[model samples]
Target: MTRRASATISTQPSVTDAPLRYRLIHDQLKNAIALGKIAPGLVLLEGPVARVFGTSRVPVRKAFEMLHAGGLLHTFEGRGYVVASPDGSAPPPLRAPLSESALGFDEAHAPLALPSNSERIYHAMEAAVSIGITFGHFRIDESEAAEAFGVSRGTVREALSRLRDLGLVEKSAYSHWLCGPLTARAVAHDYELRVLLEPAALRASMPHLSKEKLTLALAEVERAIDEPDSIDADALERIETALHVECLSQAPNKKLLGMIGHAHMPLTVNHAFYNAFNLHPEAGTLVEHRAVLKHLLAGSTEAAVTALADHLHAGQKRTLQRLKVLAVLPEPDLPVFMHRIS
Candidate 1:
């Protein structure tokens, strides 16, 4: 996700106008990572990188430092920095069921209500993380983050604090916040929670769900499948949420609706998983989603649940395959548990 600049450029010449040389370098390195040209766990050297970029050590140092603060690169005692491993080992292999313990937000603390300034910073961070724009490769400087959000540095800090509590962000050795990398384990855990909650909610609402509502929901899912490339992160999110929530909303049970609503962030994380794994043409995850929607609209809750479960399991397989090709992890040991679902 490209960060949309809210502030207009000033006519006056300033450091901001000069296009921070380090930012250019940062973007280049980021593009390389995304392209898999530089695999994760590869170390980066400041002196060598600076020489390659035809710049002095200062900007290169700043760029690596920034990446380190974002959790993309990790610092060693004397080896400079290495691309951080996604799971602190190898990334999880495909077809791996998420560990049961990995599901909920870090229970270390609760999210607090945000003030206006904090809210702005939070929104900016959320937008970046959701669309894989940042991917733990850049730090938001307190003053810069404040300026970006039109708030005070203190408010930005407050927002960062909240994100930290949620495990969405972590503090670096440099006292900067490094947004954590999205992991498959985390994604699968959220999907499990959704599977548990959403079907029940939809079932409760079946008696009250109007034909028009069901039709519209199925249409949205179909549209998403038809135009996967055209869909933005936000649109993808909406379509995924509607598939679950449209029917769930008709439930007479307010408590169930509230629970589903509370799972919104987790749902977003789960959607991100699909975004990452669906990179392969063979996955056809959108088609699988459409299949689940078809079953749901046919008033076949059991079939929908079975289809949804298979869809998720297939995702695990595809993601693992991609990761192996990228050499992030070895071929997975296909588990017997997945067969039980079938």
Candidate 2:
């Protein structure tokens, strides 16, 4: 039995967040080499450079490739990549833009939230899959995705498998990955499962629910529902996680928690609803959330379960109604890494 913690939901993804350590390293290295700090013809060892970037050799190798491609570095005869002269003169350290923070040091922050290259690829693929499904059914070509993301076929498959585990993707008989055409029926069906599983998880977590934590979560919901113009991305994430992820963390069953983790209606629907209507979770949703939390804090498991059911039912109702409008919206522009095979 593993005690779960707050759900590690990915933030609203932009292309900027998509995994690209190599690109980031490459760009920084380009700037460094161009400014002559590395010195022309000095060897760039993979191990030392990787340690500096707080990453392994893989992304650093990728970075080297980009630098080699851009003529800032060169490969010796089966030896190593050495810095190449940008021009006849060594460049001074060019000042970074005032808008940029000088925190390239690994301890302070990373260029991305995901730590590993594979994790970054996973997020990038998830975003691509989500937008693809919203538009229509599409067969994801594994090899093509590998080529597109500049990763191996294994990495592409691994990322796809994670998405499949999330219930946002599926494999066809021919071993091809398929994603959806989001519809009224599918949305309602998903909510049906949520109504049962989520509340049970909450009930299971009752013993672990803390007064302070529940109070904080309940307060977040109140602020979002009661405050004017509280429909920003973080507010939605806070309220949604407070109910769906944080409360469910109290469940001791690892398998149950894993199953609940895959159901991302809070992230998906709430994000889409906000995009379409410029609104957060509707007022009634907050009231139901508050009621469930209030009951749980009071040790009334039965009341919490009932209120949770009503909350999910209402969410399902509203979600289905909004699907029509979302269905008509244009497909988002996605990266080459995801090849949508209709």
Candidate 3:
């Protein structure tokens, strides 16, 4: 039988963090092992851990290297690393799931320190490339991207590697990085997967959704309804995180989360739709979000699940409509990193 990781995957940030994906994975594994969910002497495999993070094995391997360096794991000459048992008398602090940590914030207090510069650059590139791709297909130019972002060639490459993992970008026959014009088939496939996965996650999430968190998430919806003019990629992520990822954070299964993240193409596709059409998120979206929250607040898990499903259905409809609008748009004004291919 395959061993599943404990629900507490411990993706929390460490103090004095040097920003890198591998380092974050390393910390999470360390925390998990210390908490005893991952038993001592259990062989840690890279493939499973990489899937949990929705990333590639390259980072996971690097994380293992660091874990071994820190004496958290022991390596045999032939076999892979083993989780070194901690001192019996003292165990490390157990970390809570993300929903527990994120439940009580309002607009008054700012969110945690934003990701590092390279991290921020990664998201920026994704948004620009997504919007540009929606307008029309484009081949990416590594040098041009570096110059446009004012970052080094290495930084752009790192960002591009992440994009490739997300299935949002691809390499072409001519050895160029090609970004979308996301196809209708791709959109349909994503919806099918979400319909299967998200409701199950929402059902599993009810016990974890605190009133404080529900209220906070509800308030954000209301605010967005009142001020939906600036629904950029980051803003969209905030809304989705509050509704989707946060609610699902408590679910015992980490692989479900990974599958959802890997196939969650609509987030970018819908953002691109809005940008290409030059419109704000629909008012109906706010109402839909409210309905889901109201159901959750009233302690109706099934109803909440239904409302969430309806919201997804509505989003699918709007995405189709927006696709029609995007169909006629010209090649968008894009950063130099993108070269028109079609």
Please give each candidate's TM-score.
0.45, 0.66, 0.61
Give candidate 1's error at residue 85 in angstroms: 67
Task: For each candidate in the order shown, give its overall lDDT on alpha carbons.
Answer: 0.55, 0.68, 0.70
- Prediction 2 TM-score vs. true: 0.66
Query: Which stretch of 10 consecutive residues in model 1 shows the poorest summed lDDT?
Result: 333-342
Which is the leading candidate under lDDT? 3
Candidate 2, 181: how far from true, in Å?
A: 2.4
Model 2: weakest 10-residue lDDT segment is 1-10
Better of 1 and 2 by lDDT: 2
Q: What is candidate 1's lDDT per residue for 1-342, written digit by digit as tens?
A: 221223121111112333555787787676565555555666567665665555668777898888777766776654666665655443322221222111111232222222354654464455444333113234546766566555677887897786565455567898976653445565456556666776677677666767686688778666656654556546666765666667578778888677656545544444443443443123266677777778777878778767766765665555444333323432222211111111
Model 1: clashing residue pairs? 94-320, 95-316
Off by over 4 Å in 1: 1-123, 130-144, 153-178, 226-229, 250-283, 316-342
Encode model 3's per-residue lDDT on 1-342: one tens digit a residue: 011222111111122344667877777777776666565665656765565566678888999999888877777543456667675322233223222112121222222243654675876677677666666678888887777666788877888888886778888787688887777777778887887898899899788888999999898888878877655435756777788778887887888977877777777766544433345566787798899999999999999999988888887877777677657755455676677777
Candidate 3, 85: how far from true, in Å?
Answer: 59
TM-score of 1: 0.45
Which candidate order results from sorting by TM-score in descending order? 2, 3, 1
For candidate 3, report its TM-score: 0.61
- Please name the candidate that would achieve the greatest TM-score relative to the true structure: 2
